[model samples]
Target: MKIVKSVLILILFLGIGATAWFYYPHYQIHKMKNDSMEVGKDLSRETYLDYYRQYSKQDIHHLAIGDSIIHGFGVDETENLVYKFSNQLGHEINKTVHYTNKGKNGMTSTGLNEMIKAGLLDEAIKTSDIITVNIGGNDVLKTAKKQDYYGAVKSFDTLQETFTKNLTEISMKIKEINPRATIVLLELYNPLPADHQFSDLADSLLPKWNVNIYEVAQQIPSSIVVQTTKVINSDNPQNLSQDGVHPNSAGYTAITTQILKQFSKEYRKEAV
Candidate 1:
């Protein structure tokens, strides 16, 4: 009995030590990223000026909104989806299109709706010919990550309801601002690979969140949902950045391809 108790105590201490060793650095990195790297609620005055200013210079405009993926968090402007999407789209349309990114890191669906209410996207939305919104990832992820497996799924219903209402408002607001423009809402992708610790949670939760997005898209005219499942999983080595969450250049490329395909399909339908 004494030997068994001693062994158990030693195991507990070793387990705790291992856990702290692994988790402490991760915690610090998360804290640092939260503090220094990401652009938060304050959309800079310069970015605003540039957005509206570019509108006057171009006949076509593409505005991006939502989270870090849309913002191209770690990557440069050239490698970001918004930039690449605009360039490639411009080629197909045979016209120059200026792109504006209003995507902030860590933005949620409710945050997007609030930003619209705050008039952050007023003039840009009013002038944009194309608007691409990538939202809801953080919203569901934040909620899902907190709960156990079974509980996490059950919690989705409440979030889906709120997400539906918030997303519908966002779409409606965009339509009110520019009734003629095309809107593309990108679907949420599971960034965790099967090998990842969080893969099971992320894989199960993301699709449920995307279903709400697609259903909302169906309600809005001149809107479409682009498939992004191919890019979000870490199994696709080209898909993720160093962080393994946000899209890398190749992942952005894949997303842009899908968006452009959707745009082309919509354009043909409209032309008919």
Candidate 2:
């Protein structure tokens, strides 16, 4: 009887330890999110635009590429994030901002790399002063859907590895086409609601993928990673479209704001 009781106690302790390990990181993530919200609230579009007006160039040629987010899936043409970004950037700098959108509805990192390798985007890339890339979400979703939770988690390492390799090739191709063009890579945000079954898994794996993005950006000159996780998360259903997979108008606006903020920072850094 005592032996059975001792085994049960050990099992209970192990369960408690696992629970703590899981919940502790989530708790910290929650706190960090709240802090980020506070910081986001302080910066308005006007604030970023004002900074840009002081240091920005008089003209820009922006090229947008990647997946559905760049294609403005579930949103109208006018509500597209790239369109809004280009308009706002032009207005702020009092310049001509010509933009070309080459976004496909279901593009993956591998697809993008393949397209670039085929020289399909070479002309646009060569003429563009700015290029924005939004990819890897579809890649993650495809892997997650095809496997169990643990299986998906185990597969993320390989997914990220493949993504890193593809993205590096894509960046190199773009830079080879236009070394002067600045590449803006947007980090993927969790689209699952907090109470959703896959939310925790997404939250756990997304940062690892984003770290790959950041590391890739660091390798390529004139490239930067724009963080979207803080600005666009499952906390606000209104930010997402009916599909809950893509951003709504408001969400795109938020993303545009973040992108512009990065642009202003880059210009300021260059001016220094």
Candidate 3:
């Protein structure tokens, strides 16, 4: 009994020490903000890759794929959303829930479709119990509307059709990869006011695009859609970055919070 107690105490100390070693530098880097590499210094890119390598050996659940939004544009930590959402799900389910963020900046559904066609989807979907995606923002915004009012108005219809087709293809590809994976697609956030007249057109079209996303999500049998339009459209000043395109730190936190809430619900149901 004494030997067992000694071993337990040693184990406890080791766990505490390991936790501090891994997280202390990361905590300090976040405090600075300008240098992400400094914030992530303790875990080098090699270490980050190593960690993922280790995680792949375990049972994976809760995978994510998308553009810079899931890549955490303003959030200091790359693992910020992925870790938080996974932990929430793991706790609620009383089972190990692993998350992988397969997010790339400036990627549209066209890029995602290409990745799927190229067989890159296996990295995310092969072992995932759930998969979440966000796309179509870039596809809708690819065409630069001239300052002229007529040009912008004329481009809207073409952009709308392209957006719909690309997203539909992305959704279909995801379904093809893993039929059993619980797929969820996060609708695109509203773009900031670019021009007086164009802003109005964007406002009108944003909701319509979100509606299309909802319609597409419903078409998949075991799928869900999480609408972020309201959160992004809120009057909170901290919600947008300086460029007004991506979410600011506060906005990213809000988005993470919403994802965690949904993950908790599904995870809890699985636990029962």
Candidate 4:
């Protein structure tokens, strides 16, 4: 009788703790929004275009797709890479350049392929000049069997195959939708090291994952692969985030600059 009672109490405590962990961060954000101390602080622009004024409503250039990176999960809305890319491309192209970002948290390459198959990519491809994809991190982040860390590391071959197939399929679908659209595939970056908590499990597998992204990018035409691993690793990524998983404003800025440089070079070449 006593053992049963203790087990129930332990389960209740764990459930409470998990709830707190999940909601506390969001609660803090809400509190900040309501707090009068932050009035007139100007965290971000009121409109997306305010931060990316180089593009006009009629002459927008591209569309951005992928997961949390494009979503600006850790950064303010105006400081996202999509806006930075647009601002830089506008300068290089000598025309108003706009980009529509369609990013979600925890999106994987498999999910992207599914979304395309479901016609989610149709509208964006039809109207956009260029498309940039930044998926694959979550696909690589999947564990093989809950606690089977070693097994996950060993399954890179399978993961790589799936990633390649998905990228190829997405490229083909986009071409079919709009043959003139150029696609830019952004490579994966690992913020975790061997010494990091998740590293003993994922470190060996991550480099292989990144390499697979590079290989897959080579197989697609009209696609430019941009690498930002060095920039993300320049500082301890863990320190750059409020949560250990997402990058903060500074990290987003660094990554935005790295990608903007690449887009500038590519746009210049295309213009000439």
Best by TM-score: 2
Task: Compose the digit string of candidate 3's lDDT tens values, residues 162-187.
Answer: 76777777777767777766676786
Q: lDDT tens string, model 4, 1-272? A: 99999999999999999777555644543343233122244544122223224334447668988899888887777777787777766765556777788999888899999999999779988998778888877766665445365665567678788987898888878877876666777766666654676653453444555555555544444455665665765255642576666667777767667666554433211111
Order of all candidates by TM-score, from best down to worst?
2, 1, 4, 3
Clashes of each: 0, 0, 1, 1
TM-score result, candidate 3: 0.66
Candidate 3 local distance difference test against the native: 0.62
**Top candidate when judged by lDDT against the true structure:** 2
The per-residue C-alpha lDDT of model 2 at residue 219 equals 61
Candidate 1: residue pairs that collide: none
- For residues 1-272, write the lDDT of model 2, one tens digit per residue: 99999999999999999777556655654453343233233344233345445535666888999999999998898899999999988986887888998999989999999999999999999889889999988887777678866676778778888989999999888888888677888988998899998788788767656766776766665676777886788777788888888999999999988877766554211210
lDDT of 1 by residue, 32-74 (tens): 3233223455655122223323334446888999998889999
Which 10-residue window of candidate 2 scores lowest in summed lDDT?
263-272
What TM-score fits each model?
A: 0.72, 0.78, 0.66, 0.68
Each model's Cα RMSD: 15.0, 5.9, 21.7, 16.9
Q: Give RMSD (Å) of candidate 1 vs. truth.
A: 15.0
